[model samples]
Target: MQRSVEGQPGSPVNYSCTHSKLNLLLNVNIYSSASPHISLLNLSKNREFRVFFFSVSKVTSSNNRHRPGRYSFLIQFYAVTTASSPMSASKCTRLSGALVKQLLDSVDSILFDCDGVIWRGDQAIPGAPQVINLLKEKGKKVFFVTNNSTKSRKMYADKMTTLGFDVKEDEVFGTAYCCAVYLKTVCKLEGKVYLIGSDAMRQELEAVEIQQTGVGPDHICGKQIDWANVPLDPEVKAVVVGFDEHFSYMKMNRAMQYLSQRDCLFVGTNRDTRLPLEGGKAVPGTGCLLRAIETAAQREAQTVGKPNHFMFDCVASQFGVKADRCLMVGDRLDTDILLGSNCGLKTLLTLTGVSTVADAEAHQKSGCAERQGMVPDYYVESIADLIPALQG
Candidate 1:
């Protein structure tokens, strides 16, 4: 059976299926007023299924209105089948074999999360380089989007090259770069930033002609009152937070003092709490420091990294990437997959990072609409799993 629905120009349209006995082989075709038509086919033998399709449109918002007529769309797809079948809540399907190529053929651009999707720490996952190189060779536009704010775009590209991946600086978008772009282009701040991040963030801010303070250790040297009365930079107009190995109490106090000003803007890289490493080891991520700053400042920060549309905007604006023709592959369900979900793109979660198939299943069964966004449309054991499909 086939159904057609016309969505509002800038709003989302939702449809649900509740028929228990009616088996559906879903084929979704999206037509945009400003773009060409795109079709997606889902062949499923299970008794229940869910499908997500992204449509392109021009959405006008306070932050994005300057770029008029640009392609953008936001849609969230969630379904809880009423059928008694065991696969009813199993939307996170394992991707393998012929299914891999079929999924790859459905998108023109693929956004990969670096830390867990391609490499772990300093080592690239087995067959990861082949999969990435082959995807580019197949005429696919590949981009790396990572929330690790400790590295700039050039730094990330350099690391990728050393790890045997085909990458370029412009194709890499890390929070350190995106946060700087956000401050310069979006915020249009005229002064310096009170930054609680790494040296790489300082480099990115400098690249955009934005000055920043608070990169190194800021150890507390005096009493509480002295810390409260600490000197502040009058030119500082924003408080930017990211991954900081040298995060200290004095730094948090300084950020709080700067943010206490009503006009001072607050921004953060991302909210990922843990950074997963090889052999299942993990460490604190930027979220820990950002949260501390938020607590002290009593203010919420405008984050520019994953799960935020701004991250996708950084890539889409540069490459003219359309939501309908893009796929987001990442390891974490909260940041990576949620970014894809937030931006109206297909989401694929690999088990090589923080989230697992069981975690996705819990969200699927949670019956919470918001948590549903964290559930990816598909899950894979590893990105290396795609090598065979690319080879074939």
Candidate 2:
């Protein structure tokens, strides 16, 4: 008698064995977040049952979107992927079997989501590197699109290389770099920026020779009255928001004060609400920081991230690719899938990230155009599942 638990790496599932260990066999497979089913195949004589796990984390608030580093990813999954789920025969086709060839033949280029589709946090998803490389070898143009503003294009390329993915700096299109490009070309602002983001964003902007202030910590000096008297950069003509580790009341106040001027432009990297991290934990994303400034300034920011068509334009215009000829692959329904739909590209949803099959099902049946953007054209249990198809 033996027992076994099988799951993908970074997949967390809790199992308890109460029965006597008389060589009982238990197999547990923690699949990507996209999978909505949990199959427990019992070879033992008397114990064969499937247990449903659906206890994932919750956002602290819809408006704030901040976790204060207090939420754990250990929250049970929102839904267990099942046969009727979005990617599972009910809503879309699985990119497997004969469909694999069909999928690959349909698109000349592919856009990928960074966090859940290819890698979770600093760790790489299984078989993701091989698939990306194989796609390129087969004449597919590949690009990395992420809403995360914490890292620059060079940094993102470095991380991909560190994790064994064959990627180049230009192939990576992050919101930080896009925001800088938009400011330089579209907005054509020549003055300085009062930034409420990390040095990474600052670097991206500075690379294009955009000057920035309020990047690092601005210590709270004296009292509340002192904040009112804090020196301001009169040259600042724009306010950009991204992931700011040093986001403080002082910084927020500074940004708000700058935006108080009618000529100041408000911008953000992306409005992604939650950032998925290691250990089943998550933190407030740039959206939260951006929203905070928006609330204070009472002005809507111009976001250059996903679902906005700007990120796609960055790749399409530069690489001479067409939206109809491209495929966007990602884990999140709202950002990745919606971005694909918004840009007129095919969308593929992988379960290894923040969204779930149930989420997609709701959108499919919602009868709302907004909700419908989330429905993926295809889905696979994991990006790894595509390896065999690419090989064939």
Candidate 3:
């Protein structure tokens, strides 16, 4: 058993202050006959590990018969100490701003998102074309990934080309494409699916020879559902939910009823809780549907999205790219950033879409920081600014 005592101020004479902040320092002691020694792991052989002395307190041992002249133990303190100073605030701010330009100078691959960051609501954003051109000029590998199941990669490629950017279907990644791959490998799903998504999702389903039809008990019924049509199809063997418009209570009620039935499988594209709107107000994303379904059925749904290894496996196998060598770029933290980081690939985030640095700061302040969790290694304001930032 292990015990932790916190909120102690100052260091005892036999104790060491491992950190400048007293609140963070910890002292551990075991009431034993011998003092335990501490060894450093993964430390450089050239540099010495520091240790200092503080005061110690001896108390009576609770165990009566086993003790001999009162056992001695050590109240040892340990922390990851650093004599190296952090960069100046001014310098950090400047470097943080310049990080993207520096990255462009180093990294050879780039991935982009189609909506919001590239084209917002059918219109190309400013600097979108220039960024693509710049990447091409540098001969950097580029790909596009999106959670929008409303359009196929081919359609997205065509749209990007029409909007004056050079793009290809082979370089596109979408939730619909990922779902098709997941259906192919994981669950081996087939037959008619009761789709509540856009024409794009239906097209993909047909391409895979999966039947798309009206809701019925005979088919492997599922919904590529969005906000407006979360309605559960009672006959569906699988409940496939995606991003839908016009989401409401009726749709959720239907989804609940179907999911509550025994032997039904539930699937969702991604678990993004909120999405960006035109004026910056965030609307609940697919995660809202996921929770409702989970609550109704009292279980978790099988998700197919970024940072989900199924998508990574499909993409890596299809391209013959090693997961470590591949780089993933996206605007959303839960999906894009998490996907790359989870799959052992380099991850990058941009401020041009869903998440912002302010949001990241808020998360850190909330006391949820992890040593190796879902944070992007790099961040940029936009793809267009990447080159300059890298050069600087």
Best by lDDT: 1
Instruction: Name the lDDT of candidate 1.
Output: 0.76
Q: Is candidate 1 or candidate 3 better by TM-score?
A: 1
Better of 1 and 2 by lDDT: 1
lDDT tens digits, residues 325-348, model 1? 789999988888878766667789
lDDT of prediction 2: 0.72
lDDT of each: 0.76, 0.72, 0.55
Models 1 onward score TM values of 0.78, 0.76, 0.63
lDDT of 2 by residue, 1-392 (tens): 12233332222234434344211122222222222122222211111221222233232321211211122223232212222222223345667887777777878999998988899877899899999999999999999999988899999999999999999999999888999998887667779988888888899999999999887887777887877777898899889998899999888888888877655677888888888776678888888988988898876676788866678878988999876568999998888887876555678899898888888888888876457667888888898888887887
**Candidate 3 local lDDT, 1-392, one digit each (tens):** 11222211111112223233322122232212222111111111111222222333333333332332333333444423324223211110212554455445545666666666677776777878777876777777777877777678798889999888887788887887777666555556543455545567767767787655332222223454543354444445556667666455555556666655534445667777777778777777777866876676565665666656556666566666564345676777667766664554556667778877666555435554331235566566776655464333
By TM-score rank, best first, the candidates go: 1, 2, 3
RMSD of 1: 9.7
Give me the displacement of residue 76 in model 1, in angstroms. 18
